[model samples]
Target: MLNYRLFGDLSSSAAPLVVLHGLLGSLDNWHTFARGQAGKRTVLAIDLRNHGDSPHVAGMSYRQMVDDVVAVLDTLAIPECYLMGHSMGGKVAMMLALQHPSRVRRLLVVDIAPKAYPPRHQALLHAMVGMPLGELSSRKQADEWLSATVKHPFERGFLLKNLGRKTEGQFYWQCNLPEIARHYLKISGFPTTDAVYPAPTLFIRGGQSDYVADTDLPMIRQAFPAAELVTVAAAGHLPHVQTPAEFTVLVEAFLG
Candidate 1:
């Protein structure tokens, strides 16, 4: 099972909310949001396989990722709960809802659609893999190295969160870069299914993100008959991080 951080009172009457983060992101991405939601209900933030503190396994597929989450729910004895996921994680949530509809009470997919995406993060992945972790004297140096490929400071900082120091000077990535790279194709592709999840579902897209396009709505509706899409103005791919306040409001309204 993937590593998870739980917040809130598990014994609360309200159903738990399971949060999954985007590609190259960990449970930490949802830490603040999960902590806020924990006041009313249980919030479980997960590190998908190959990311964060989770085991760096060989294969990467939607089925494998879904099973990892299911194992966590089974271990927690949670028969049903709400689920929210962003980007890559959103795809995982959608797959889980489709394959195991009864296990999901409500579903929220952020900034992604039920379709295949072209490999867009190759440069980022290459930068991550090529970074000489052993020689890095400080996080700043690592950031400098990443700056060559990852021009955006915010993105560089976000990716740097995965950098961990083993000793006084030596550093390594928390994610399994090699395996993720090997399975890039699988990660970019969505698994096909005739299955449908008819539960109330909300798809939140960033106003500036092309991840969820108008063309994808019909397919989304076909899979999730009750799904609705909302846009977060002036936000990009990571709307939860970019405009957390607005994002939280949308999530709370849907989950309520």
Candidate 2:
């Protein structure tokens, strides 16, 4: 079972909002956003399988991830709620809305399309798997070592989120590196589902991100006929981080 750490007041009167983190991310990534939505709605931030405190499963397929979310929602007795996700999480949210329409009242996808991404993330995953954990001294040292293997600083930081040190001074990864490394391809690919969720869907695109290019709109529309697109200017893959105010405004309007 996937362990999910929730936030905010679950007993709030407003409709619940479940936020799923991206690849290599945990519920902590959505702390600010979840806090902003507090009182207005109950925010349930999930740490997907193999990330954060979640259990490591044998497979990393979207179907398996969706099942994890379903289990959490059912356990919470949340009848229907708003679904929001970013990058990998966006794909999961898309699948959940498609396969389990009754569970999602509103769908919000951030900076990703309904297409398969290239295996470009393989190098980063490889570097993570190859990290010299035994010799790693501190997080700064790990950062310096990872800098030699990974070029993109932001991406390196994202991967570094998994690095942790034991009380005995031995370093390890908080994430299940072997599973993520072995299933990199599956993680980048979206599942093929014939089900189309016609619920009012919102696609929040990052202006600087190529993840959701104009060319992908056709596929998005083909699957989600009622979906609408909104772009956050001067933002990249994680718009909520770059432009939280704008992202919040857009989300509030969409949820209304």
Q: State model 1's lDDT.
A: 0.92
Q: Candidate 1 residues 45-142, lDDT tens each? A: 99999999999998999999999999999998888989999999999999999999999999999999989888999988988898887788999999
lDDT of each: 0.92, 0.87
- At residue 197, candidate 1 shows an lDDT of 99
Model 2 spans > 4 angstroms off = none
TM-score of 1: 0.98
Error of 1 at 139 (Å): 0.9
Following a full C-alpha superposition, what root-mean-square deviation does model 1 have from the true structure? 0.9
Q: Give each model's clash number.
A: 0, 0
